[model samples]
Target chain A: MNSDSLWEVFINACLINNFVLAYFLGICPFLGVSAKLETASRMGVAVCVVMLVSSICAYFIHRVLQALNAPYLQLIAFIVVIASTVQLVEMFIKKASPTLFRALGIFLPLITSNCAILGVALFQTNKGYDFIQSIVYAFGAGLGFMLALILMAGVREKLALARLPDTVEGTAISLMIAGVLSLSFMGFAGLG
Target chain B: MQPEKPIVIRKEVVRRGSADEFLKGLWRENPVFVQVLGMCPVLAVTNSAINALTMGLATAFVLLLSNLLVSCLRHYIPPQVRIATFILIIATFVTVVDYLIQAISLEIHKSLGAFISLIVVNCLILGRAEAFASRNSIGRSLLDALGMGAGFTFALLCMGGVREILGGGTLFGVALFADNYQPWVVMILPSGGFFTLGAWLLLFNRIKQRQQRKQPRLQARLQEMGSEQ
Candidate 1:
């Protein structure tokens, strides 16, 4: 693997191409948990933890799969590995810190299916990132996800007071807001 | 055990009524718009109108089938093991859809990719199964699933239409303008998703306020007639 600068990898992952905004991964939690800022922030941190661990685990697992010449097993294997890891993490958190667990407990299992986590693993494998790069990319992706969630949460919080129509009150409006955000992100297209 | 009270027994049946319960998912408690149960695919796959249609259809199919089967087998499956069973069933259908899409075209399949498989974890499907389908009949569950699926599809289509038009300067892959038309590339990006959705929210609120203003005037007129009566 070619050695890449950590800062370069970080900037690329976080800003130029975000997981939710650019890559279109982990949008489920981005919208579901983003209804409230408190929950969104907590979920963001939880997801960051999962992304870090999963990225490391997936990098090694991908190497093993490549050695075995069983790339077909990639998707299912990644999902199973992520699911079991989340389970273990959940149990550890439950036993270790009930308070932190309570704050982030419900979101832990949800991370197992978060497309962003798996997407990071897949992207890292495809891009052929080294160990350090994989970790940095994961960190950057998590930060990106957090950035989008926080911005959305802030806007949605203010939207709570707005009198939305009976027909298109919640999801429809949130989606339109997402459309505009997607538009603004275009300004960054020439950055890289 | 003490004899069951008639009111309590009836209350249980009322709560479990299939048709009313199922219909509720369409409007009063729409999984996408009203309840906001599933947001991942709603936001992610809706970049293009066609993608939105396919994703919405796929999700609806999963929701409908899973709800029916889960409701049918609710009695046999123990509560402790129900979630596992539910995931297994949902995953099986997702696998079927995944292969079917692959067979159709690599391009569309590539675009959708893992988001299709992730439908298994979409809170809307599982949430309904646990909360409604587990208790309702096959017929009621089907209607509930249909209603929610359509509602979700409608929402996705709306987002996709706006994004595709502004972002790509086209609709459903057809260019609306000539060579001079320069698409606002941001509309297709991540932040554009946020700002577009936010503006739509504001617009929806404004329309709602206008309607609310009209309602009070109409109510006042009705009250005047009532006073004469």
Candidate 2:
């Protein structure tokens, strides 16, 4: 585990293989909350924190499920764990930072079904990463998601004033921008 | 404790015929384009027509069955446990579909991979089960599910057909262009999925906008004719 090298995991997650652009995870929030830069960054932080915690929990329970030889339990266990973790995180945020809570509170429940958090847990287990590797991978995935969210939010802010055609005003234009962004993310395909 | 009160509620609550219920999903409440629910498959499996079709069928099946079951059990399931029960029901169907796909065709199963299971988390199925099914009659719930399922399938087919034709230079499997035709290439990739859906959404929105613009013109012309008469 010590020799696995965390840099590769970080790079592989953050840039080489992004969650939103590459894997198509967290796209609902990617489109919904990305209308404002501040909101996007807040949601990104919330997702990052939840992803980290869910990864830790998923890694441990996964071992127990493997020992019990109940492979089918993976979906239910991961989802329940993630839902509770989001609840826990939401409470903590409410107590710790009221202002931050206000910004991210609404999106907190939405994170339970984000799929990226669940995707992190599932993919890390699939790759058979060690405990430390799972943590780093989760962190990387979160940061990658955050980066994508921030970038899209910035663009959308600028687009607020642009005069797009009536039909392509909101979701349509956002998707087109995301498509082009996904194309750009493909440039990193050869890095790793 | 008779079934008469429930029937009154059903009759009063659901005024529209089944056909109206079904048509809404196809156009106004389309799961893909209009409501924009279940986008993961909308943008993912649409790289090919056959894959998209298979995925559409699987989702529709799960959706139709789940809606039926949820509607039947709505009165039994307490409101507190409704979400969990819904999740469990959805996961069961997804697992069944996952295994059934593997049994039917290993290649298609392999192609779909984790996404087959991810259908459980799709907002569309849960959204429908919660929003429409839980409160409505079983017959109406069935209509809603079928409409949504067909609308979702129609949207996927549209995306898949365009992507397959442009990206692979083929409709389903047969080659359409010449042997030397230079395919767009990008259409088959992940990015191509985003591009194709985005373009289709743009087209749909433009058509909708044009119609909205015409409605006012027609109204104004009617008023002018009324004054002249």
Candidate 3:
């Protein structure tokens, strides 16, 4: 795990094992916020920022937890820190862009529950990636997530105008499209 | 006579209401098929039946315990910090379950990966905590947790069962078909998870639409019977 270069880690996290499409992380916001391209891009950016911040926090916290010899508190510690970070992000976003904040809505706080963020925290710790590797991994995962969300939003926008059966209209169609996207992502398996 | 009739009706209504609370999660408002609350575990760990069932049970355990704790402390927890407090309680339980699963079987633990910890993020559990458990009584929340947990398990099994059968030509590692039976390898991949869930959602939509179509007819027939009586 530690032998891989930063580029390999980035590629592995971004395209080969894309968070949303490949690992099934962050599906909630991926589906819920991807309805509009504008909102999706904003949400993706918000998530990317949160991921970057929380990833840094998690790295330092993990080191502290290790020094303290209280590994069991890792989950609780990570979550509490993530929650606080999200609160900060929420306030920042609200001040910077109220429309974006409103558009993001509950999902902003709900980012606390976005598994992709936590997954990065946990995966980084588990994979034993050092400081730089962890940052690159988070960046790659965030990029992958944003990429997936933007692509999904674009597809959904087109899908809205196309005629379709009632049963296949909503989440079912989205999942089907996501499945195809995931299949295409699988083609990147050899890249890393 | 009227007073007595009203009392009996009220008692029956209470009984039915309690039953509804429990029964609704099993089918009507399933956490997965209907509400689509937690998609990570639903898609991530369900590549095999055993993995799916284990994940389901682990999630149910967290959901059940968290619901119990949240309802018990509902009043003590203020509105502002309730979400954080709920998460703290949930993360504690997930940590416990994480170690518990690790102790039980390292291989299953490995297969489940960080998902055991990710239970903290499963919207279904937190949704229940915020939406149902925090507002409801202890007994009611307990029933809700059980029902939702069972429903979650049922849905995971549905996905796991199909995927395993088609993907591996086996159920719970037991080979069911002859040597020549070919497995659809895609059925077990990440994309397969999406496809299987989409298929399930489509089926559920169809069933719901059919039931809705029959509902008015059934209501009219009932009204006609009442008039005749």
Candidate 4:
């Protein structure tokens, strides 16, 4: 908003430089919990919420670390904050929406370990984005992740009945689909 | 894997030894190729052989050190707080590694970037700490970490070697092909990373299937002989 175009930030993070397709930030849930479209979309939303929270938390934390001259605490602080935030999110989702909780299963809590969430925090800081830009970057990363997960889920749903070679029936086929999807995503590079 | 299988491996290792614990992750239970636990670093930093090697070594160091600590302090860490504690230990080591890489080579450190810090979320490391290290004895935990770490490193090397070769017609900066070789530029791009990993997975799957089929065919032939007799 200040200097860099916000739309470009969104597009670059969401498509041109997708967290999953380009950065390989959140492949775990992209491959594991992305079997069904509904679940995949929910997971995507959950990640979006978490990424937004963590990005804000990290932005403030970065300011503090800079003031204290203790930037080394960034990794440990970011992770602990993110992990506990994920726990809070998990409990909230559990009590607030049992159906969504059931759909999420272990993956809700597993968000603590999801690199994409942390990657958003790390990458935004590296890029030196301001508060507004950081939030946008985080949301864009979450959207890109959701986009990748949903696309992969759609393909995998069809793949369940497809006659695949026994060797490539499971993770291999998923990887192949992701590969193709990533290949197509490269076309967006020029758009951004 | 199946929940019951680890118990079976535990029983066999109790009687025979802990060698299988280390050997399994190398191939059978490979964290990357087989289990697919840590895909971010596996795919992201393997654009060059040297980068892959450095990233693998950095991860292995963290995995080994963190596993040792987790295993050593398993009992003191209540189940309620185990994951949090394990992560703290991992983050500490990752920070140390981040600085260490920077000290060694500014370029390598910059190249590795946040992915080095992202090692804390590798899942392979955390998965091992929770599943094997936190429950097993220290000696067994050490072996498990070494094996899984090596398996991850090996898988990275395989991907890196292929990507570097095809992407640039070089292996660790040595030209493999002729001077005029038209390098497949895709191999170095992000999509190339995904495609290369998928190819490796395909190759490993086929090899495993062939081995499985041979064993089944051999068993069928032996059954026929027995019936004839």
Candidate 5:
């Protein structure tokens, strides 16, 4: 409904306000699953898929909830939709390709709880973006989440070999790396 | 008569167990520093002391109520549908809280943004419900929720206090320094959240490592003293 262009929305969501780094939407999986690049990328793609589906579903659900004069149910509705959609995605992958499923099996269910997916739905609605804009925004957010994940995974791969204090070995070190990454991403501000 | 007597005696044990359940969440099994269960809001709303405290309390409220409800209904919920049921219950309570927060203070609500509603997905709340509440009694679940909630609130306070002090040169909106004092603005930014939490985790790990180191020495000293006696 807003007059913002699709490109601007995409750019804004992807870079200027990255879900993972800027907004800190999905730090759980961002830190948990970013240890290995292969799993991280696959997890990123799986999240992207779920995000897109939930975004579209949210757009329509918002319309319905508005029509019914029941806006209060939006949060509950959005979460239910997201959980079911993730279930559907899980099933589709399980049947389509057992290998890919094996790679992504565990992370798929976790995608339900990932704040980024729910964030996309909530933000798109809060911004009052039209259906097309919502989809673009979702895609952009997904891309941004994936980009951050892959980048972190790459850095962590090397960090594994670096000499570090025993105290700063695991999560503390990764969080520090993410902090630096977030600081760098600040440069992309105002691009849109 | 014998069973009744044992039940009375076990009541005292239950009270002591409740104390342990409540105390563990404050430090040992802290939801933030130790368990690191809910990181999204832990980092997102912790830009300031008030925001951090408010968000922490809000989450604790939800966790408490949901845990109570979940434990009360645990016997009735089927295993296969339990997760779904849990989500539904959590989502419902989250909605109630969402409205409650909005009514109480729009300003705070605005600051929290969608993260307020996002409480439904907070792994800490759901994690506690599924792991602790579902299996525990109502009284124990309440204590567990309180402890974890307090621990979570305490952690948020730690992060918020540090970030606000460094980032804005103030605590809870009161200026801590002169006008010329330069705030470490980075401490309040998105990256600052990561850095601050990481530093806290580092400190926690250091303390834990030191404790592990001393634990064996203390045991050895005790053994040596016993042998001498």
Candidate 6:
């Protein structure tokens, strides 16, 4: 719990090693749901919220597992916890705001299986981040995810009008774009 | 008079088309190239030839087994619970692969790490099972899985081959030239994965375009002959 530099944690999470671009976590939604900016932003916010809560929850869960000497169950338990938490969130959102629920829709449940949420938990536990650091890291990671999604959405929106062959019209092209984006991100490696 | 006018009609037989269904996955609806379903592992583990092969084989095993099992029990599985069932089956196979990898060698297992475990969450496996396997027979499901798996593997290997050559200045860990060859270290980095994949895709698109151009002339000539008929 040597808690000191929070900004470093944030910068590291957001840029030096982006969740989507660098780490390759949460790519499912990054590609699947990032067709529109609005949806991508909403998904980003939702993922950020889940990351924050899960990070806090996982801190406790990690401690509990350590106490019980059952670290092996961490992955399975974390998944179950995240899934149930998402279910609760979905029910709450549905009861509270129908419009928002519709916007988020299937992605809410999708958060249950999203690797980013679990990745954050696993990473935080592995890194042994303090509470403040964990929160900052989660926020930064969420922002990073949002940044990548927005950029991708912007590119994809324009790409719609561009001429593409039938063979590489869809997924193949998207992957190629991701590859280029990944290459650009490499330039930022020396920044940190 | 009406009773004497009764006519017997033959029912159209619905035969299962196995090979067509399976072969379609190779190019028509390739999991990686066409559907782009499983990009996570495609981009992540394809930094090297060995990793690409390992990931490909592991995914194929899971995909094949899950497809077979899901197809076999498709009728009994309620629609609502089908996804859960498919995931559980996938997770079981992933666990088996994970342990088997660990038992065999630590280095390769370490390289693969969470990606192997994350196979349970790979949408491609569940996507195939729910969309294709659940509807087709067990045999057909296996073929489809094999085809899709092969396509995915082929795509991964292509990516890996390009990345390893440029990124590491070697192929399959073998040094092709002398030590003077300085590899573009960036290729080995995360960004290299994107560049290699994108370039390869652009190449694939160009080839496909050439093929499309050649198809219309052939089609037009066939139409001219049909008019004569």
Better model by DockQ: candidate 3 vs candidate 5: 3
The docking quality of candidate 4, as DockQ, is: 0.79
lDDT (CA) per prediction: 0.79, 0.89, 0.94, 0.90, 0.94, 0.81
Q: Could you tell me the lDDT of residue B127 within candidate 3?
A: 94
Tens digits of per-residue lDDT, candidate 4, B88-188, equal: 99999999999999999999888888999999999999899999998889998898889988999999999999999999999999999988999999999
Give me the runs in candidate 3 sitting further than 4 Å from their true place: A94-106, B1-9
Ranking by DockQ: 3, 5, 4, 2, 6, 1
Query: In order, what DockQ does each candidate have?
Result: 0.40, 0.65, 0.93, 0.79, 0.92, 0.50
Residue B167 in model 6: lDDT: 83
Total backbone collisions, model 1: 33
Candidate 5 C-alpha lDDT tens digits along A133-176:
99999999999999999999999999888899899998999999
Local lDDT at B185 for model 6: 85
Off by over 4 Å in 5: B1-16
For candidate 1, give the docking quality class from DockQ.
Answer: acceptable
Better of 2 and 6 by TM-score: 2
- TM-scores, all candidates, are 0.75, 0.92, 0.96, 0.92, 0.96, 0.85
- Per-residue alpha-carbon lDDT of model 3 for B73-189, expressed as tens digits? 988998988888999999999999999999999999999899899999999998999999998999999999999999999999999999999999999999999999999999999
Candidate 2 structure quality by residue, lDDT tens digits, A11-67: 889888898987888789999999999999989999999999999999999999999
Q: Write the per-residue lDDT of candidate 1 for residues B129-208, one digit (tens) a residue.
A: 88878997788878888888887877778878999999898889999888788888766766565655556555655666
Error of 5 at A94 (Å): 2.0
Task: State what share of the real interface contacts each candidate retains.
Answer: 0.49, 0.52, 0.95, 0.86, 0.95, 0.49
Alpha carbon lDDT at B154, candidate 2: 95
* Per-residue lDDT of candidate 6, residues B30-111 (tens digit): 7776576777788788889989988998899989999988999999999987777777777777778888888888899998
Cα lDDT for residue B213, model 1? 89
Most DockQ-accurate candidate = 3
Candidate 4 whole-model C-alpha lDDT, 0 to 1: 0.90
Error of 3 at A191 (Å): 0.4
Clashing pairs in 2: none
